[model samples]
Target: MNEQQRVMQIFQAYREVNQAFFQVMAKVAQKHGLTPLQLIVLRILKEFPDIKLMELSDKLNLGNSTTSGIVDRMVKAGIITRERTESDRRAMTLKLSDKGTTLWEESNDMRLMLLRPLLGLSEEDQQQFHRIQTEILTILKTIKGDVLHD
Candidate 1:
């Protein structure tokens, strides 16, 4: 194959791998009663409970309307609470409710269970995997943006 053809084949393989990974994650999230995007939002909220809607959108790389819809659904499901900042009083912040915390913990347990076999790899192999994944992510981020902030 020509160099260009070889590069296209590699790119296609990468896309397939990513799609498969996401599909598995989606199935797992569905089993846990959450969509993959909802799970991601919950995880982000767990880490940054005081995040604003705009900040959340920026962090998630989602449009405002899309993030708002997710937030609305999560709120209705009692998985998240929107509260006004005490100081700002008008500015809103996102936080996980007790229910949300429980769901997050359970989801984390499920993920850990699924990852146990990967964790069982030899220490060197595990480290190598981490290093390589990080390098690939760095390259992807760089391609998307100059400083690779994400």
Candidate 2:
């Protein structure tokens, strides 16, 4: 196939795969009484114990107001807490609450259960896939930066 055709095919496949994966995850989230966005925020908070609201907004590609609304809802639900930075009282940082941590842990367990079996490929195949995925991810990051960098 020509270069353009090959790139298009790969892009289409990637989009479809991601769509399928996220659809499954959406079902999982619904089963847990959480939306995908809420789960994403909870997971991010777990990864970064104390993250700034502005930083989270940028990282999540959300508007400041939207981030604030999401955080407010999460706080009301006891999933996360936002507090002033100890060193800089004016700046706010977010941390996962006990409920959030529990949800995050459950989500992780579910994901691991699904991924472990698929990762049992031959060593060579695993290595090849890993290398290719990394390359593609790097290229995607570059493209994303070009499009979104402010």
Which candidate should be chosen as best, given TM-score against the real structure? 2
- Window of ten residues with lowest summed lDDT in model 1: 111-120
lDDT of 1: 0.89
Kindly give the stretch of ten consecutive residues in candidate 2 with the minimal lDDT sum.
111-120
User: Candidate 1's residue-wise lDDT over 74-145, tens digit each?
Assistant: 999999999999999889999999999999998878877775776678999989977977887888887889
lDDT of 1 at 58: 97
Q: Please, what is the TM-score per model?
A: 0.83, 0.84
* Model 1 segments more than 4 A misplaced: 145-150
What tens-digit string does per-residue lDDT give for candidate 2 at 1-150?
Answer: 999999999899989979988987787688777888888898888888899988899889999999999999989999999889889999989999999899889987886776677777899998998898899999999999999976
Candidate 1 — which pairs collide? none
Task: Give the Å error, residue 102, model 1.
Answer: 0.8
Q: By TM-score, how accurate is candidate 2? A: 0.84
